[model samples]
Target: MVKFGVLVLLSAIAIGQGETTIESQCQVCQEENNVYCESESTFLRMRGAMKLGPLSCEADEVCSNSGNLCKKKTEITNEVLNVCGANCQSCSADRKYTCVSRNQAALCLNGQASSTIIIDCGEDEVCVDDDDGKAFLCVPSCVADYQKLSVPCSSAAFTTPTPAPPTTPSGDNQKSICQAAAVNKKTLYFFTYADSSCRTYVYCERSSSTSTDFTTTLSGSCSSPNPYFNTVSGKCQASVPDNCESEAPST
Candidate 1:
């Protein structure tokens, strides 16, 4: 199989053709970060091509647009800005790239622990560290010596609340879940969708300071590697559950 990196190099070559070519004067960053694309050409080329570098900046380093590559935080002459925006609070660089598994990874946005986004490698890709082992990257599974790559953290390093199903639930149904919890006097509750499809689940919680009041706090479709939502465990699992009413949702 063609490697993802090789495919990127091919796309870069193709972009140079016709009007899509990037010129020397283009005001673009010399390097790309794991989160955002720095150059318009690079961004355009990678929009749907494949996953690109999820490179991270060191604790003392900041992603600089200049050609010298990453620069020390102290060297910045202006206010420091997080590319991921305000919601992501600053955290240590050690939490930057978390490996959920060889095929899955999560990026600590703006170095923030609470704000993380999962990075699912392509079907043929696997998560691995860069040559320097300073950043987490996704490469073709066929690449050799992948086990030698560094893994910044284990699955326990960061965990996101199970995502709700892609389909929005009816208001009455959402209210019902919370109402059941409230009636049971349960502070928190997790339950599978009525259809018992492995794709989605609901997480409900009682409103603070209101014992009788409850609300649906979060819900979303289970992601890759753990696509099936096991009703008994109230979490996504790798295997099919006996109660599953449907196969995993199409990607």
Candidate 2:
């Protein structure tokens, strides 16, 4: 009987050791602090405070157990801008705009009309246009166009195929004559109906000229090479030259 009891005790001890080995082999958590278990029955049910090791598990296993166990990392590029997504960041003029990424910066051209320059930024990067005056933040949609208008005397001529005015005068009466001619004959139309000449003539005829000042004259042709209109100034202003921005890429 003594020998039999001794054998039974040894058997029980061996069983306990086996259970401990199985528990150690099972992973209790994942790398991202997620809990995992191979078997529901093996999990401990006790509440209260339990000191657990760092949650560590294989990637595939962790993903299989919990949908939120892991996340894909984003790749950073060299062309990204430094001040991407921030407010009022300056842009590079050479390429028309600058972009910043987590690891690098890049310059891109603005392809759209009135588009502002921009930089590349990582998922959390911010950029802004210092030139905007309002300090607007840069976004993926941001683009820049820094070309200036070249307004030469010849460029002022109407581009439309329509016949030119009877003559291009050479004196002070040139502007006035053009206005009077445009009004009376209605034959002097701007290449683009919205030509600066149209505005100048209309303004001179309505506001500057009077019954007695009919002979008065203004200098320069009214046509402008630039198409932009400054509503605030109520006039047409020249745009910044591409070279000007090149010297100062930012702001």
The whole-model lDDT of each prediction reads 0.39, 0.23
| Model 1 lDDT, full chain set | 0.39
Per-residue lDDT, model 2, residue 23, is 11
- Highest TM-score against the true fold, candidate: 1
True-structure RMSD, every candidate: 17.6, 34.2
Q: Give the per-residue lDDT digits (tens) of candidate 1, residues 138-192.
A: 5665542333333222222223332223454454665664454344344444354
Consecutive 10-residue window with the lowest summed lDDT within model 2: 1-10
Q: Residue 208's C-alpha lDDT in candidate 1?
A: 62
Cα lDDT tens digits for candidate 2, 136-243 = 232221121121111111111111111112223333444445444344333212111123332221112222323323332222112345423322232333653332
CA deviation > 4 Å runs, candidate 1: 1-165, 170-172, 180-187, 207-212, 231-234, 242-251
Candidate with the greatest lDDT versus the true structure: 1
TM-score for each model: 0.30, 0.18
lDDT of 1 at 11: 20
Error of 1 at 46 (Å): 33
In model 1, the clashing pairs are 34-54, 163-219, 163-220, 164-219, 164-220, 164-221, 165-220
